[model samples]
Target: MASIAMLVFGGNAHAEGGSYNVDDASVVGAGKCQLESWLREWSHGSNGLYAVPACGAGPVEFGVTLNTGHGVYGPGVNPSIKWQLRNGDDKGIGVAVATAATWIHGRQDDAQAYVATTFGIDDARRLMVALNAGVDRIHGESTHSLLGLGMDVALTTRWTLLVERMWTHRTITDQGGIRLAFGESSLDLVVGSERSPHPSHWINLGWNAAF
Candidate 1:
């Protein structure tokens, strides 16, 4: 019942990775792959299981997001591709173009494309920043322009902080989270809010790994 409600308010369902609502301008690497999964519970009363699996080939990464409502409601899958224009290292600047198409079961389909930039401000502290500008086209509705900004700071060897905000014409969302690194994988906890006609607040716990 609760899952059905929030699935209707699918404003922050954009596919990136990790716990941020905004996508970043980085890819795993050539021949490298990653998997991200999370469990979310909304303050409005709902739960979801989300997964993302992606791999990099050449200058591009192919991925998809799986969003399910506790095995109930389905916005099913979001297929995405990211073309890395510049490496996101401690070099000058990094840039990428990302696009995704969404199909929510029984609901309308939507597609989005965005240009993103990432910068490494402090290599010692592992401080990074990312920004995005995009447009989302709804199947039966008008196109909505989107903007986003995000940051990640490594607080310590095992702990890192993340904050991000994304806005569209119809809705705005913000998220703050932390990651606890354990070698190749990490655990995540995120809390976020969305501003819309019917607001939804959620808490998410996630896992991320690279291979």
Candidate 2:
């Protein structure tokens, strides 16, 4: 369970400047909750801290994140919701729709709405692929479309690997990470790069707990 949460929200650390990233299509089991926290440091000496607590009820999941950072956009609150449309199985795929709203200090609020799909691959179903496309709206600004692709591969009983690429307008970001699980908790270490005319590197360390 902890490993799953890391896979779902780990790449969120790469989100900077109000850009959206791909989110997982799966949810925690009903009545279950997950807590995730991460610290991100960029090559330019800026850093941020993020914390998210999510709960699943029936076929829907709800989450909110507290973002405190030293960047163009300061502190913020991000709330999100995802509804499971289908559950993945040996013979079928999974789908979900998610939306997130962001309110930043002294800046225009932003929102994103997207649809995501997941497919189980390989004979053991240990490999999964996800794709998402969505629209982002910034208050008093033009809307833009976003696209993302991601994969999760199980390396062992207690290890998993993640890779993802996301595009929003002219900016493209890529992320890769490995998750280590111990009992009901996991740790994720991720490295990512972004191209917004110039290249910048980001490193993230995340901890996830399931309860």
Candidate 3:
């Protein structure tokens, strides 16, 4: 399975005055299920855990992510749906469309809609590049546009490198990570930095299992 990135915390978090975000564009295959969990710690004393369970049905994928923190806020949940418009092959490109709705215990709700496209850079289709563009609407606030660029390179049969940058509103975040795969599961370690407005840094340790 190819590594898919999940949107950790985004404009919704920012809307609540929090500064953490992760975004990705990979999908579980038809009739497949993916379980992902990660913990993100910020430079400041805030930290949280993001756990998501996603499944694929025909050309669409569905997921729900739960966010729990130990700092300035309570728990939150995000439910999302993604539709694969085109499936990329060894010689072409693939595209998907997604939307997520966020609800936090004491904050306004948020909704995000985006389009993702992936292309194979190698003949074996092991090297891939993905791009995402979207808009996030926070209830009672202004809408913000989101953009992201990422790449996945297979290092070996069971190892891959992941890198990406995401921009939403005036916040920009850069992330780099490695994925080690074993059969139907993988482990990921990621570190990222945020700039301006609320400058901060974070590290994410995660695991992904597919069935």
Candidate 4:
């Protein structure tokens, strides 16, 4: 249960700016700040609240996530950093590396790291695709490889569609959502399902802002 949230929301992208599960490249320009918050309800009698606040400095972004609620084993904390390697102009391939450590009840529980790639499909910047692959190192469990693929489409200035499917050898998760913008802030309504700890479905209401 905890692994699903961490990988789905915090691992590569960690709610990377907009889309839910797909890790997007850094967009927080130097000296800028942003906040992300979400309220989630699961079909199997569980719910949670999450908050992520982040800032940018040069090519790197620093952030942390606060998770709280039920049905989740470790609603701990995740502190992470991401570095943009190089921005691709001609091929539209942008790359980044993100790493984070999780602590539950004051004890380190797990660590995650991922290399993410974003590919632009058009010049208008209306559509984008992302790929993330990483390693999950739990305190007492054997390490596992994590991988995910996602895509987002901008239907208009105020509307965007997001879809993602991420997995490892043992778990699979799928998310679909719509983003509605209000100036520098946006709201999202997402539906998701995961195949771990039992088959579960959830809905999330998320809001993001840049400052």
lDDT of 3 by residue, 1-73 (tens): 2212233353122100011243334467788888877777777768887777888988788887777865734
Tell me the lDDT of model 1 at 66: 79
Instruction: Compose the digit string of candidate 4's lDDT tens values, residues 1-211.
Output: 0122355332212423443755766546689988888888888677878787888889888887787755575467878888888664236788888888877778777787888788878897678787888887777888898787887798998988888888864778888889899999989898888787667788888888889
By summed lDDT, the worst window of 10 consecutive residues in model 3 runs over: 11-20
Against the true structure, candidate 2 reaches a TM-score of: 0.86
Give per-candidate clash totals: 0, 0, 0, 0
Pairing residues by index, what is the TM-score of model 3? 0.85
Query: Candidate 3 overall Cα lDDT vs. reference?
Result: 0.66
Better of 1 and 3 by TM-score: 1
Please state the error at residue 74 of candidate 2 in Å. Answer: 2.3
Model 3: per-residue Cα lDDT at residue 29: 71
lDDT of each: 0.72, 0.68, 0.66, 0.72
RMSD of each: 4.3, 4.7, 4.8, 3.4
Off by over 4 Å in 2: 1-20, 89-91, 106-108
Would you estimate the TM-scores of all the predictions? 0.88, 0.86, 0.85, 0.89
Model 4 TM-score (2 dp): 0.89
Q: lDDT tens string, model 2, 164-205?
A: 788765677787888888998888888888777666788888
Indicate the residue-level lDDT of 164 in model 4.
84
